[model samples]
Target: MRHTGADARTTLQKGFHEPVEKPKRFYKTVETTPVDGGFGVLLDGRNLRTPGGVRLVLPTAALAEEIAGEWRAQGETIEMADMHATRLANTATGAVPNSREATAGQVMDYAASDLLLYFAEEPQALVERQTEQWGAVLLRAEEEARLSFVRAAGIIHQRQPEESLERVRQIALGLDDFGLAGLAFGAALFGSSILAIAVQRSWITAEQAFELSRLDEAFQQEQWGVDAEAAERTDRLRSEAAALERWFKALRT
Candidate 1:
């Protein structure tokens, strides 16, 4: 779909506006306590709830502590936008459970036309660069998924194999709610399901994924000078990608 930095940045930043009336922090101590599922963050001995008003329970104590760290880091005013772990935890406990199938469907849809599958027809350098950087990731995906993907040049809309798409679907369907949230977030952030899976599996670092996802723009920037606005947008996406990587790491603990 030719998703540039601007496109993915817009997706990540969508509906992420800071509250006009920021609430002052009213809690003294931030902690985690065992809950029904795993652990829940406690603010001054009171249970913390998601924005949707659901009890914020996590699958692991480590993840719960991570969320608690966010709350502890807040200043006098709570900035929800800065609480990536808490926001993601909210999605995991609140929205993702109810929309698991729809989330998996979205992942499959992105896999159908994943950015890694597309190549530039012209500019031998860009084409070669795409092949060199993207080929290994696609190969690894095929090996792991036991399915082959169709490659397209110049964005002519080449269809990936149904079996391949189904394989990706199964991969997405197998994740727990928290993993699913990370996968869905990464897929949207990178605009490539393959890249998202690669990062989630530790096959590639988030920095590498970000670079690969923006290869086209990087090459263009190399040719025609970098744009300040575009660079700023990509910088924000880079930070968010790093935060997602940390979240995945915390999920392992």
Candidate 2:
């Protein structure tokens, strides 16, 4: 079934009593309990599902096609080739085991049951959700940093707007995910570099580039440092960018 997760939980939750298909559940120490009539497998991610996105964790390509219709398809989806790579243990030599010694199908069914249960009740869909959120944080810091530099340049002299905006673009693309603060600092430096490029291209004067360069230097010293909570570091980044902007103003006068 193609799951859209339209009604998925807002955050990761453990409301499901069943398991989901995840590579991790194949081989981990667990304490099982017999309930109702069927076995209750002890797994968390299965019950908790994803943390943020509204997507279900699909098995990789190999697994998806392999178990397309078996009802026990999800586990069968992950080929031994893939499972071997992922480090699952105590699997059937040729198939999965339900408890001790069963055909691959039986083992596959148990695994599948857990997998489907997880998808039904989990939170976000994938790990990318976290990365994207962090990415947004970094992107915001960069935008404000660019704004400050442009303002400083205008206050110092009759700076051209098109040239400054174009410079900001180059730096924004070059930012690496060292963390939020690193991303912000990288963006500030990128802004400076873009201004330098404009200077080199005769788009802006060399003096303009030199003026922006002071802000870049300040980013390296202050905004670039790692902080304890990671996200909180963006405040420091903003402060540093502002400080550098001030320095640029002083230099201009």
Candidate 3:
């Protein structure tokens, strides 16, 4: 038996085959309230807290209403997967407070070995495609990120300049907790911090970034026929990237 992308996402959503205990929906109404700094969601008359027990105060009333809408949409059983906005807010409030620096470091590590920096040594067609598509993105990175990355022909380890890494680190560090979480998620999903940054800055749409990141994989799938599992993975990746793009936009506004 082969594990699938859906299987992995299921595991991520519902821990390791854990029993799904359906909590009875107790709240009659979901609403938003103005807090000190921002707004928060209220169920009935009680304020909603994150899984970490902190008051779920969002920076914007719009975002708070969005999260409240998620709660309102739930029926008898709350589908956690459907509440991506709430989950992202929870991460921004809970996890990111303690792990901001570490998370930024992890994203910087990805920049060091970014997928865009590696080119395939192959037939002329594939090489040309990489140069045309990936090359444009690299140039965008150089211009936007203000750093010149070292590209390599093959998998041989080539060290990126320290100045380039520092520039990326500076950009990552400048993002707020919500933006940081989205960037980390997007970078990991697409395997390119450049694409993730471009999407974050609205230079390109999530679909464009996903397509560019999977250029080689798509080429292979077209030539050799697509595997069911591989196609499923691509769908899941696109969905996640779209979600991240939405979250980033909401967070910025």
| Top-TM-score structure, candidate number | 1
Instruction: Please tell me which model should have the higher TM-score, number 1 or number 2.
Output: 1
Among the numbered candidates, top lDDT falls to 1
Candidate 3 residue-wise lDDT at 7: 33
TM-score, prediction 3:
0.86
Instruction: Measure candidate 2: CA RMSD.
Output: 24.2
What's each prediction's TM-score? 0.93, 0.16, 0.86
Candidate 1 lDDT over 10-124, as tens digits, reads: 7778775654888999999999999986899999999999877888878889888889999999999998877888888888889999999999988888887788888989799
- Put down candidate 3 lDDT per residue, 1-253, tens digits, no spaces: 1112233234443562477776777888999999988898999989999887999888877778778888999999787766778888888888987998888886777778877888889967888998998898788888877869898887776788988878877788899877887787677767777777888889888888888877778878778999887777677667777777777777767
Return the lDDT, model 1, position 215.
Answer: 93
Q: Could you tally the backbone clashes for each prediction?
A: 0, 15, 0
Instruction: Tell me which residue pairs clash in candidate 1.
Output: none
- Model 1 — TM-score against the truth? 0.93
**On TM-score, who's better, 2 or 3?**
3
lDDT of each: 0.86, 0.28, 0.78
Q: Check candidate 3 and list the clashing pairs.
A: none
Q: Write the per-residue lDDT of candidate 2 for residues 176-208, one digit (tens) a residue.
A: 111112222222232333332233223434343
